[model samples]
Target: MDDLSRDIIRQKYPEFKEIPSQIANGTKYMPYFKDCNGVIDDTLIDVIIHKENQLCYKGRKETPTIDVLQAYNFDLLFTYVLSGWEELAHDSHIFLNTIGNPSINFPKPPPGKYYLVDKGYLERKSYLTRYHKIRYHPSEFCGANPRGQ
Candidate 1:
């Protein structure tokens, strides 16, 4: 899906030499990873619950859910996927449970490179996040939004 999305961008704009890490002018220096985020997806409910609070969330309605974390590169190819976590788990908790374990966490990015994450994740030396309350979406200001909503 990420590949398909990137392909469409290249197709529309053939002179795709450089896409800034994050920028209208410039938001990041080179040796940086692209944006990545977590999302909750509805899944078939099991008869039992691991925790009482894992029942359901408003965002996902009454169905059980799983939190999926994915990372992507500048070309929007998926670099990683961390999943199989309960829906009610805090984003930070899910992250901590994954990173410290050798079998799960991958090697750290090279010294200067960092992954852009959502505000839920901590602002560590290895990762960066955008302003919490700011509107970073281009469509917010320009009516030429792609969503067509």
Candidate 2:
């Protein structure tokens, strides 16, 4: 949907916009999923907002702004939110903070698979074993130096 339509919907239903949908086969499914083998998975998702503007000077300066929203998902059974921020000229970061929190209440991972993540999700071996969770920072911002370091 376009920005205008999304904004209208969001205004009408603020909480509705934050609810995560399970996407499969080009359809929005319920947040919970169950497989034939009696396995269930709970999806964790987050949203990011980006703003762009056009500057114009017609006797009086004016700036028009547009906002875009992006959603991302990670395996909650093995990850958590570490950090998320907007980059100056690149995609935003959706850092996943890993945790060892027991998965006793959650569905089990597929056989021989502890967890699964897309390429955007970062994984570190040292941290995985020690923390039992994965941390992800968008690749584009990896090389940028810290503000005061």
Error of 2 at 3 (Å): 23
lDDT for residue 67 in candidate 2, whole number 0-100: 21
Q: Mark the regions of model 1 whose C-alpha exceeds 4 Å error after superposition.
A: 1-60, 140-149
| lDDT digits (tens) for residues 87-127 of candidate 2 | 22111123231223232122223332333333444453211
Off by over 4 Å in 2: 1-84, 87-93, 98-112, 124-149
Worst 10 residues of 2 by lDDT: 33-42
Q: Per-model C-alpha lDDT, please?
A: 0.47, 0.26
User: For this target, which candidate reaches the highest TM-score against the unseen true structure?
Assistant: 1
Q: What is the lDDT of residue 122 in candidate 1?
A: 66
Q: Write the per-residue lDDT of candidate 1 for residues 1-117, one digit (tens) a residue.
A: 012222331222222233433432333332332322212111323334456655553235555565666555444445455655666667766555555566664334455445566
User: For every model shown, what is its TM-score relative to the native structure?
Assistant: 0.55, 0.18
